[model samples]
Target: MRTALDVHISEVGPRDGLQSVKATMPTADKCRWIDALAAAGLREIEVGSFVPAKLLPQMADVAAVVRHALTLTVSHPGLRVMALVPNRRGAWAALTAGVHKLTLPVSASEAHSLANVRKTSAQMVEELRSVVALRNEVAPGVPVEVGLSTAFGCTLQGAVAEDDVIRLALACVEAGVDEVGLSDTTGMAHPAQVRRLFTRLRAELGSHAGAAHMHNTRGLGLANCLAAFDAGVRSFDSSLGGLGGCPYAPGASGNVVTEDLVFMFEAMGVSTGIDLQQLFAAREPLKAGLPGEPVYGMTPEAGLPRGWRA
Candidate 1:
């Protein structure tokens, strides 16, 4: 991965990682975690999702969290402050909250889409149209990213066809999303499959296709990420302490672990630019914030494999 791959790792721990656990962290604790990560050299972080509290109790403080993170993001214009929105309403709220990037999930598996968002794949595409329209109307330059979850496979639908993933990815781009992210929501992806699908999507959608959101469920999380990097994906999403796993999503953990990922890239000389020590420090606040929740990651627990750079 060091030779030619120069991927940018975006930590999703605060947003995706925390939302999976059963406990909730105070908004101030969330801000402190974000700052710790940023000071550690992380260029981007997804602060939280703007979903209804009734749906996900973990993300109930998303609005306030985003507001707090906004203050810090101003100091580093290169740093991205992003949030996840489930629908048009969430997107609108995120835009008003002053987030730099907004991502929406669109499942390629129709059955999974209905189960997750209560809408068919087609209906979700239509909803994205309105999201894009709203972004253009209010924040014209703001980036709108569609994280197409379950792009590889779904627990509900069993297997998601490659053709379906490609089709929905193209549709998301056509629907006006700035970038379409491929996610292994259930962690059923293989390196070869990731290489193939990413290649096809890149050839078709060009610049609109990017990012890889993988899970550690199958233990191929980092391997799949390297495969995506090999296939030309620059943006990779991960979470600190691997905090999140959808309650309704069976066997699906949150995105990849941030500590392990940064260790993999920076150790391999790929230049993630994130300090492992500071990243580990960020997790302390997360642990304190969400007490009683089990956080995941091996590198943090192992201490960066003996004699590593700070």
Candidate 2:
């Protein structure tokens, strides 16, 4: 929320990263990692998801973790605690946990939608409307957004049409969501596609256009992000150490790396309001929590440029 920051980065490591991994970080470790991230100046973080404990045991303690994260707002004022909800039940739980924001994943690819959420694309939009209604009744102040997953392409169905992505976004808007972000869930996005789709997204949705959730699956994460920026996107979703991938999307891997992303913008003289040194230090808790887990980042490996300051 800093006025000086040119772009908004929402850290999704806790939810997206942890869920895709084999280990369940202890609740205390999760809190510590989150604290480190907040200290590093990440204003918004998707702390966890609301799903059946049997389905994702890693997120079984999500409610408790959300409460712990809420306490951080005292020190990190303006920090927005966010959660991912797959359905109306999940939305209700997230609202009850006092989350500042709720993001629902509605896949643009019908095959991906059915596989991930057990619902068709149309059914998922209806689900979103129900979630929005619940939010209005109980937590009207909370913002509800949709991450239109597989907007770029899908491994299951392959090459999702652009029209589907735009249609689903407008449908979510009509369902009362505040914003709809395009997600490259399969990491199949290229710079030109990213530019064209995001430009069309901004034109159609206007102020309702949201974050660019690019994956580094094909090594185009940074380039796609730069393209999104060129197309007028100001918000992005990344993970510390590039730790996330879709469980249902086969062959998809790695969320955009936070360290590399902040470094990229800062090196270009774009203010991210995030200190690079502290951001690197934040990776310590992550390593401790998920030991031996590969956390990728060019900036962390090479160190900052000589005499560099952010």
Candidate 3:
């Protein structure tokens, strides 16, 4: 059970943010950015994805990035290094790299699933089962998270049914994933929908219900996050500087800004354990790594509110 004061913010800029853009952040700079984030008290970060370099050139150095993140875990014992794995091969690479957590994206919308991974949602669930079995065989302690992307609404196939989302989540759980999260891959989720779906997710999966991956494309990312938080979601996934988009779903913006999300929690008396100022400072390495890349954040631009402390 999570108290109102506890909120876990997982930074995903290195993997999700970088994968969407054409520019590849230097491996060394990625480690620097991740170190800065951990230093800012961010306990979990999706360091990189274990995908083929030809598929996502930006994540070409995932192995090296994971090694660097592991060193940070040595320094900051609570830090969790996570990576995204698309299939069995990626999962093998992530397990070999010794990531603390691995997230597999399973699109809830069949159209999006076929487009994103060339598999149907059910096929992806079967793939998840294989990945989970591999994890148990190799590293039983490591956790596997399934991000049900396009759960809210899909551009390729609009109006994703809530029942479908729930069914898919159950399949993932039966497949042995440690957690299953909901992702607004297209940023089409409203606050009411976010609350209702998250509540349903909790009712169905209980502690297996995972993070809320919201997008700021429609400007409701933070609102939807707050709704999910109210619905008892403790973990939240965001990208520093709002730097991500979906390759399969066109016009999808970056994730909810990490700086803004942290501020929202810390200001509301929820302890995110993040240093707002240091989080802002972490953006420098991002800029240096991807020159000319657009990094968006309201808190960084407006500065802290008058008389406010985090």
Maximum-TM-score candidate: 2
lDDT comparison, 1 vs 3, better candidate: 3
**Model 3, span 1-310: residue lDDT tens:** 1333398899999989999998888888998999899999888899988888898998989999999889987778778899999999999999999999999999999999998899999999999989999999999999999999999999989999999999999999999999999999999999999999999999999989999999999999999999999999999999999999888897798999999999998888889888999999999999999999999998999999898764
lDDT of 3 at 189: 98
The TM-score obtained by model 1 is: 0.95
Off by over 4 Å in 2: none
The RMSD of every model to the true structure, in order and in angstroms, is: 2.4, 0.8, 1.4
Top of the candidates by lDDT: 2
RMSD of model 2, in Å? 0.8
From the highest lDDT down, the ranking of the candidates is 2, 3, 1
TM-score of each: 0.95, 0.99, 0.98
Better of 1 and 3 by TM-score: 3
Question: What clash count goes with each model?
Answer: 4, 0, 0
Task: List runs of model 1 lying over 4 Å from the truth.
Answer: 1-5, 305-307
Taking the tens digit of each residue's C-alpha lDDT, what string does model 1 give over 1-310? Answer: 1223377888888887777776777888888888898888777789989988898787888888878777875675577788989889999999998899998889888877887889998999999999999999999988988888888888888888888888888888889999998988898898999999888888888989878999888889999999988888888988888766665568887668888888888877888777788888888888788787777889988776666655
Output candidate 3 Cα RMSD. 1.4
Clashing pairs in 1: 13-240, 17-244, 20-244, 20-245
